[model samples]
Target: MPQFVRKNGFWGVRVNWVEHLNKKTVYRRKYKQGFKTKREASMWANKFLAKANSGELVEQKIPTFPDYFMQWARIYRFTHITEVTKNRYIVTASHLESYFGSKPLNKITRSNYQEFLNEYSKDHAPSSVNKTKGLIKSCLDSAVADGLIRVNFSLGSQATGNKKKKLVVIYPNVEQIENILNLALERRKPYYPSFYIIITAILTGMRLAEICGLTWDRIDVENRTFKIDRAYNHLATDKEHIFKTLKNESSYRTIRVSHNLISVLSELKVNGSNLVFAEKNNPYKVPYSNGVKHPLKKIIKDLDYNLGDFHFHSLRHCHVALLHHDGIDWYSISKRLGHENLTTTLKTYAYLVEEDKIKSDDLIETQLDNFLTIGEKIGETSKKHKIK
Candidate 1:
């Protein structure tokens, strides 16, 4: 219902409605003024009431950016995301708070959001900027659906960063890889688990988290295979070494192991712990990925290989390079690496694949040269017989 009133020289109308907020019913009212005639005011009130009755009106109470982001993330993202990923969201919320500072969600315009992104990107990497932009966009999109705002400010915003690009994927050459493996095998001691971890990484191409989370049950000595179904969450605050699901469905795979690797693993004495690479004293706990890097750096230093900025993850790339050198197809390599698809493998190792192509071209040319030589010899023999 509407109440008609006269104020000064114009007609006005007031409409009342009821809405549910926080599981409680609340009354709301809106007033329209400056109508020339009572009939005009009545028509406007009718349209407003119809919209309100149909639940098409936008929400009146809008939350700040940080408030809505935290709310949305807890409801939709917190359950499925890993501890590290949740930490990233928390950091994003912190940034929103620092930048927006109690600004209402609907008040954030496109230009305002873009300016924030541009400013944030000045110090962050492009990837980091893009991730933040994506997160904010997702949150604002939900806000739009909830009728908190009419548009997502982050929709058309560009992520620009002046941070230096990351270095190219650096993997050791074949000789360097062999030297590294030999050195690791020689220096391997019960106290040093990095050696074994490095060997496993080179052979299996498993991510560091996967290797840390690996249990004895996952390894099948008889079948010479290991299953990757879980990863260790080193970032988990609730537990020292929490096991979580793999990165994606593709990460849950079984990879074949060589006999030498099986021998090395079988020789490892498991001290009542199911973990293959448990901590020296605490069998229940696993070594952090960073802990594995110190000894690796020492090994690289000893080997005197000029591989720039090599780390444990470089072994995974080394494994891919080995596979490519052995003439394995991209699809097989993809499966071995447990990639989501072949495209990921190809994209990551496109340069190495191109190098392999050049080698293949040379091999083909050598075979053609041998064929030509054989044909020329046969032609000479036939001509000599005809002359005789």
Candidate 2:
């Protein structure tokens, strides 16, 4: 190693070469900013020289993102799991796979990833898009960890109801919910399964898939409870949905059946059909021959209702809000909804609550005033007794 003196009187390891275009005297600056020793500076300079001479020659071969994803999924045990996760990931990878599957891992850009999210969220709910983005981001991050990509480009955060543009928050008042139900029943529509589905969800606060896969065997009529064990889902590559286990460990818990839901189930014909909702012989995910989409749409149209387009999930929101309004603790609600923790239940349903925030605030303010009055009385009594 040797030191070269520059025109500015700085000493460092340097490389001199002819300018490729002008054939002028040229110099290359190495890590002269930090390296105090010529030997230390020369080491990095030598590596840079090696990279320049042989790095391109050796070829910086790396697997494509899709290729890496396939490899990662291969090792991952996707089998023998809940169909809910399968379908969710399938939907998630669908957006990512179509976009970056062929591109080299290093070529994926943050802007390109953001575009996928922006476009998807335009039609679907922000929560749905964010869910898909989270899975994609996790996969791409794994690619970076595996050294298949230079950096993790995808950025994901949880879905906030206020932030999602495509989300349709059509919260009907209590009167409206009852009116929708009453109207659907009055229409005498035989094709609509969502009528019962919505009723049950509003009563129980179960997730959509849980309501769809409601089984007779899981129902304990004597115990007045029901267990959630399975769910329906589709993978990204899957053309059709399939039956799978419960969505998660939390989803496997049992719920105490409400009087309305229990009464609804008790009247239904429970035959060879293991499902409480679906009929026997031609059993389905959700009960009814007409399915939820068109049949439910017809029912809503007949009633001249667009706010009721939320389908079964809205009923879940209704259940949570109903409970929240009734002074139910979040822990109980979380358990009832099969959430892993209270926080998940809180974050997911915070937006679903009505803006009738006056009740909670007014109650707290009244309690605080009472507490202060009591404290003053106790202070006065203590002074009178000369015990303070």
On TM-score, the leading prediction is 1
In the range 303-350, model 2's lDDT, one tens digit per residue, is 666673465566677777777767887889999998888889878876
TM-score of each candidate? Answer: 0.80, 0.63
Predicted model with the maximum lDDT: 1
lDDT values for all models: 0.85, 0.63
Model 2 earns a TM-score of: 0.63
TM-score of 1: 0.80
Per-residue C-alpha lDDT of model 1 across residues 1-388, encoded as one tens digit per residue: 8999998989999999987767888788999899999999999999998898887773677789999999999999999988788999999999989999999988988998888888898788777888888888888889989988887777767877765753444568888888888888888775657688888998889999899888889988889899899998777555455788888899989999998887886555654567778776877566776788888899888877777777788888889888877888899989988999999998988889789789889999999999999999999999989953
For each candidate in turn, give its C-alpha RMSD to the true structure in angstroms.
Answer: 4.1, 10.7
